[model samples]
Every structure is written in structure tokens, then in C-alpha cells.
Target: MTKKGKKGPSVTAKAEDRHWHGKRVKARAAKNASRTGSKTLGPRKPGSSRAGAAQGRAAERSSGATRRPDAPELVHGRNPVLEALREGVPGTTLYYMADSDERVREAIKIAADRGIPLLECGKPELDRLTDRAVHQGLALQVKPYRYAHPDDLLQGTAPLIVALDGVTDARNLGAIVRSASAFGASGILLPERRSAGVNAGAWKTSAGTLANMPVARCTNLTRQLKAYQDAGCFVAGLDAHGGSSIANIPAADGPFVLVVGSEGKGLSRLVTDHCDLLAHIPMFGHAESLNAGVAAGIALYELARQRHT
Candidate 1:
């Protein structure tokens, strides 16, 4: 007889190997699940094949992985899109569906006049572009805002700067920018994180003031404050509980940076520590605190008055 071919592993040995491999896979999956807090682990059962995918999607959404912070903003709705175009909010593209309302037609005309490219798409495409927001067959893709440098705001002999700390609301940011422009602020300073950037809401709320206002973003608000201080600018933070009123700050006459915090939390501890002084807006009413935008406006008006006087 011919030499017997090398026998393959018996069925019993093959089954044992498969059992150990499955156990190792399950062990590794369990370890990963424990670390990630994910309930779906290991190879999913045939009956629940979609469960793992569903869980992964949920995780991504919860972590904000789907948000594109750098993407060009899409201003939706006929009225809003038309207003943005009218306000000269720089835009790259105008997307719309046919048979739109008068507002949409007006937006298209403005976009054409401004030389912004127009893309006529279907309702489904509009819906996708606007993330299913109420687009009303209109959407304008706004150009990404260009932020100024913190040093750029240090222009003029006595430059006035408005810095926001933890002011997350885009509307509040817009309102602050409006006030800053009115009060002769050199520019607006925002921390790179935990602060609102100039977006569609801010553009609407600013009433087009953003077109003129130069906004800057910094990596560290505290370090920026120190730098401002070194540059002979007084850094005053707005706080509900402070030693002195904002109007009474002695450094109001010189170059100043007015740091405004969120309406609810006031200022963060780190920011407060870094400030040269903490000032409160004096109020006679029983109200606890003013809105961040309102408070910033009041403080800025006071500072402007000081400078003129």
C-alpha cells in the first residue's frame, strides 16, 4: 500500500480547538465591553445579528461623533436663508428646490447677485443637506468664519477687548459681538473650547454686526488673560458676587479686556483667579442675575462711558 497520507486532526481535536478559540474570543470581547461600558459583546447570535450595529450607532451618537464642527454651516428655512444672504453673511453655495416660495426665490437672486454658486437639488437632497431641518426648500452654505489672533485685537492705544468664558450660546455670543461693536471694542476673544463660535444663530442675533466685528479664538483663556495683562490691559471678569461694581473699576480708562461668563454659572474658578479683578453689575432689583449678553452690554456701556469721560 502507498504510504499513508499525513492524517488531519481528528474531528474531536478540531472541535476542541474551536471551543478554545471561542472561549478566547469571548474573553477578549468581555474585556472590551467592560472597558467601554458596551453591553453588546462577542459575535452576535444569528437571531440578534443587528444588535451590535445598533449599539455601535447609539454609542457614536451619544459621543457626538456624528457632529461636524468644521463643516460649513447650513442656514436653512426660506426666511433665515434669505436674511443671511441679505445681511452679507459670506456664503459659498445656495441650495434650493424648484417651485419654492418668494423668500427662496429672493435668496436665489441674492446669491446670484453675490456670485455665490447655486445648486438646484430635489427635496430629498435639500433635506439631507440641511439635516432634515425645516428648510422650506432653501439652504445657504455659509463660509467658515475666519478668527483673528488674540494679538490682533491689541490694536490702537487703548484697545477694548471682550472675552467670553463658558458662554456657550451662539445667540449670546452674537449679542455680545453687537454690543462690542457699538462700544468700540477692538475685537472679541473666545476660548478655543467651551465657547460659542460665530454661527448662523450668532449672525442673526448680531443683526449683521459680525461682518464688522473681529473675533479671535485662544487655546487658553487664562494664559490669554495673563498675556493681556502683560500688554498693559486690565482683565476684569464679570461675577455675580464680587467686591466692587463694574462701573467703579479704576482700570476702565486704559486698555481693558472685559471677560463675561455664562449666565447661570457666572465665571469658572480658574478664570476668576486669573482675573485682575472681579466686578459685578450693581442692581437694585430682586433678580438674582442678568443674562450674559445683557450683563456684558451693561458693563461695556459703562466702560465706554468711562473712556469718553
Candidate 2:
């Protein structure tokens, strides 16, 4: 059985062995990576659901509708989160730092009492979640907001309703919502395109007033204005050089629709034509105009005062 200078095995066999070993190593590494990647969002600690709820969450993550159009989705900052929780805003999850402050602790307690899922994350994670907007180590995941149809709003006996033409700022929309709520307007009418919806920024700016207020999305602002006019609503559009002053309008005492346009462009030609009258807030000073939010607030306050008087 002894052979002189015989190699243990053929070079081809050694090469095949090394190739097989490399493949095995790669398979092991891939399996490890898969396990690690499963926990990319972080570890599943206590209070983190892992049953059907987890599966449903996974499904939501996989589906395109995880963040619905109407939902609030993300709300940051302590006041915003605290106010949202206090206002009973539907929260899906509450992301907070493990080492947080008193305000954050209060928010955490409220979220826990409300049965919201609490996920502990770091500051960097919070920053990433909120697009680096000073989250203050807290973020709330809210449910989608339910938007009302244009026709649905007409059914109510709202004395005054505000329709936005092209005010695209979310803060403006939020401020308008607050003003509308304060002045006892029925709801807000927003165009589906080229206008802002009730997003997180709007919700935060609204100070949780959006929870009580209903917003409707209109397909065509001009058509909606015309419908309001046809339904006996005095549709008045706001313009800098409007023919009549807001205080001089007698129709404002009755059920009317206040149409506010964008800050820069004012009302469009079609929307302007649909208005029963153009009402301007007279200013003796040199200031030409006010922002959409300010103008709407002043208009609403005026209308409310007239109605109360």
C-alpha cells in the first residue's frame, strides 16, 4: 500500500473541497445576515407585541397603504405629542427615549394608559424619524384622519364655512382650522390638488383642534363655490382690492361661505367669478394685505362678532 512520493489526493479534488467549504461559509453568513436584518428596526423588548398584531403590523409595513392619506401618521415635539394624547388622538405607537424627561415621561404614561404601543428609541433614531426636526426625544405615530366629502359638509347647518383656494402651507391650514373652530364654523373645504391637507405639521399647528374639526376635500373650488351660491349661501371671496369692505357686508350676518385665496396670488379668476361678492378687509395703514391665516382669522372673528351681536 506504500507508494513513493504519491500526493494525498488529486489537485482537482482539493480545489473542489475548498470550493465546497467556501460555499458553506457563504450560506452560513447569509443565514446570519437574514437573522440580523430581521431586527433592523431594533430589538423587540417587553410590551412589544409579537402575535397576530405583529403579523398585521408586518403586513401593513409591506403594503403600500401603511401610511394612509388621511392619517396623522407622525407627530413630534413634547407639546404636540402631549396635546395629541390628551385630545384622544388615535395613536398607533409612541416612540420615546428610555432616558427621557418629565414631560416625555408624562407623554409615555398617557400613551401607556391609552393602550398605545411604546417603542424605545435613541435620539438619532428620533431625529431620523422626524426628518431632523427637533423631536425632543419623542414622537407619536397617529392614525389616519378621516376626511369628509364635500357634499357631506353641506348637510350641516353651519352658519359660516371657509373654503381655501390655493393656500398650500400646512401651518396656514392648521391656523385656519383653529380659527374656524374658534369662530364656530361648520368645517373647512380644501381642494384635493394644489392645497394642503391635514398633515402632521398642520395637526401640530392646530394644537389638537383638528380632532374636533371636520375637513372636506373638494375636487373643484370654483364648482364648490357655485354650489354654495346656488344653495342660498352668500359666497364672498377675499381680495386686497375687493369692491366692498367686510364690515359693510350685510349678507355676512346670514349663512355665508368665506373664500380665502393664496397669500401671493389672491383668488383665481374662476373662483373670483363664482363669488357672490368680493369682500376686502379695509386697512387705512400702508400695509397692503395679511397672510392667509391672519386674514382668515380676522374675517372669522368679524363674522363671529357680527353673528353674536
Instruction: Highest lDDT: give the candidate number.
Output: 1
lDDT of 2 by residue, 1-309 (tens): 112332221122221233233432332233212121111111123343456356444533432121454443588888888998887777899999875478899999999998999999988887767667677888898776788765545544334779999777777888899899899887799988988777676777787888888788877788776666555466777776555567765555555788998765678888877776666776655455577888899889988887788
* Each candidate: RMSD: 23.0, 29.1
> What TM-score fits each model?
0.70, 0.74
- Pairs with steric clashes in candidate 2: 70-145, 71-144, 71-145
- Predicted structure 1: lDDT: 0.71
Runs in model 1 lying further than 4 Å from the true structure: 1-72, 97-105, 122-124
The worst-scoring run of ten residues by lDDT in candidate 1 lies at 36-45
TM accuracy, model 1:
0.70
Model 1 Cα shift for residue 24 (angstroms): 67
Q: Give the winner by TM-score.
A: 2
Off by over 4 Å in 2: 1-72, 155-158
What is the Å distance of residue 146 in model 1 from its true position? 1.8
